[model samples]
Target: MAWRRDNSAFDFHFFRFFNSASPNNTMSSGLGKNAAGVLNMTIQEVYSSSENWILYFQSGVYFIRNYDYGGDLQIGVDSKTATQPRLLKRNGTLGQQWTLTKAEDGKSWLLTNGLLGKDLFLGLDGAKPVMTADKTKGTVWGIEMNESAGLPAAGNDLITSVQNLESPPVSSSSSSSSPTASQSATPANSQTAPPTTTNTGLLTSPTSSSANGITSSVEQPSQSLSAGGFEFDWGCCGVGFAGSGAGGKD
Candidate 1:
């Protein structure tokens, strides 16, 4: 779980220091009487160091509390009425628990009640926030982390800071996209084989002599030769030759 690394004792001291430094409710002013107003008031409270609803995300579990409001504002359900959420004390009840579901846009999130099948949203008719079955823009909220919350500026920065001390160091093999052993060992030109050699077979024939059908062996000069898959032609070897096989020999 990603969390504050400070010892429990130190955490307690830190919380006390910040809580004491926070401003009181009397400091907030010029706010309306609705959820928007509450958000503005909370933001003002944060600037003034006043204790507001402190939202925490730990090990995927979410908790929102405003100690100044006498305890955590739990989602309490009235038995008689339809399941309408109201603020109550924190007693580790399921109804008080919530999970933050991020929206299609990364900036906003929907806070869903753990026990009741309802989402926290700003009711149009009332100044207080409530829970409903339907999700809407009113239900979406954005949370910003501050240094007072014991978190670094960036989420990745937080992960990097604790990476070495809290968790095992990430191996270079796992972090890098280096070439594999086989890929590095193979030569690029290995796919090309040497040129091939082919022979058309020597051509030989007997020519008939003009005198009484006597036959004579044809003596031809070197003609076409196949080397490296290419044919090379040597013109007639003898200039005055006029025999049947007098052309270039193979």
Candidate 2:
């Protein structure tokens, strides 16, 4: 039972702030519908500050996101790594290109852009709220009441200004490809007895490996933007993970 930091009160406060800025039907101008699909929040909602969805999984409604963008999306994580939790936008991509999958717990729903087949869940452990995956339990996330209901149906054009705080699917961890040259070769002495195989080994491999027989030894170099510049390399596994500027510019 991991212990949650008790942000429930804080989340409630955040919700009130966001709720105040919205209306029954925000699509005042009215645009094309979900030809692209329906997503969780609108780009407009994201930037409005007042309309941002609650992005945590406590007892209230929460937001979940997935970086299943054909492996794109990047964020300035730190000097060495471009955070692993950023979602890049598709060209001509609309922010509201997703739909919500109502869960058995009607209040909770899975937000998907209508492709890549995935859902959202609350990462809680033992009664304590934690930020990790629990494939069996469901992201178990909820939003501020019926905010999701307020969203337009399948054909409605989605609004921008929104972003979900969802995690990639449990399947994502299973299907994702881990880079060949990732971690520094763990010292033979550093190795721990393998845990149950049925479990993810979080240490298992994601993608393919190099000719060097699965690049068992790799080092995360000091992270810093190259003299060239600092930007996200969406099409690739991000510069930080691919090795300094792996997908970056020269």
Candidate 3:
């Protein structure tokens, strides 16, 4: 079976693809190591901050992206002589699209780029840090989930604030039917009104009042903005793998 983008919730899950040749080493973009510009894919021991990636599903293919740096894994040519895997910005190009087929081992996946050629498979070249797609030298990768990569749900702070606002503390002071000396002296139309609450059930600001020598203030909760969804921001520095490899266009 082949893997294609489905736009499902599973697409957000972070994963690490371990090279079958070296189970302890996985693909890394080297973002945590301060690599910049176009980066060649390198292998490293699983590091949630750098090794975890999101197979962003879109259209009919997957755009493999670094979980932290957000750069898409792509194929680039070097002087028209060598083709290598690179980490670059997502441009929706054919070079950035990939498909995954389950290997015969039943536990590993064979990654291929149809645009490059159906025969070319993504794999490391011996012990080098570069990724190659030679027909005879492709890698089978073991996919595993990184549970710690999950992020907090969007708008959670807003929900909790609304819940607390729904039940305001009941006023403990009792009301008296008879009017006081000061109340009788003041004209009914000239008396001040109580503070107004907004439609969101939050006070505009803190307020205090004094009546018959007694003073009290309404407690207010800190305001928070609601977030519609999570957004990943990529910096100028690209996350490269552990080993140094050939450079390509950014």
Identify the leading candidate in terms of lDDT. Answer: 3
TM-score for candidate 3, please give it.
Answer: 0.50
lDDT of 3 by residue, 27-98 (tens): 665655465423433445434456666664333345566644533233332333245666654454455556
Off by over 4 Å in 1: 1-51, 56-60, 70-86, 118-126, 146-250
Per-model C-alpha lDDT, please?
0.28, 0.23, 0.40
Give the higher-TM-score candidate: 1 or 3: 3
lDDT by residue for model 1 over 166-231, one digit each (tens)?
112345667632111111111112111111221122111211222221112222212221211111
Q: Give the better candidate number (2 or 3) by TM-score.
A: 3
For model 3, the stretches where C-alpha displacement exceeds 4 angstroms are: 1-5, 8-10, 31-33, 37-47, 71-82, 127-138, 152-250
lDDT of 2 by residue, 88-189 (tens): 332212221333334454333333331223332222233222223344532433333212212111111111112232333345448642111111111111
Question: Regarding lDDT, does 1 or 2 come out ahead?
Answer: 1
Q: Which regions in candidate 2 have their CA more than 4 angstroms from the true location?
A: 1-51, 54-85, 90-96, 113-115, 119-134, 145-250
lDDT score of residue 111 within candidate 1: 58
Error of 2 at 247 (Å): 40
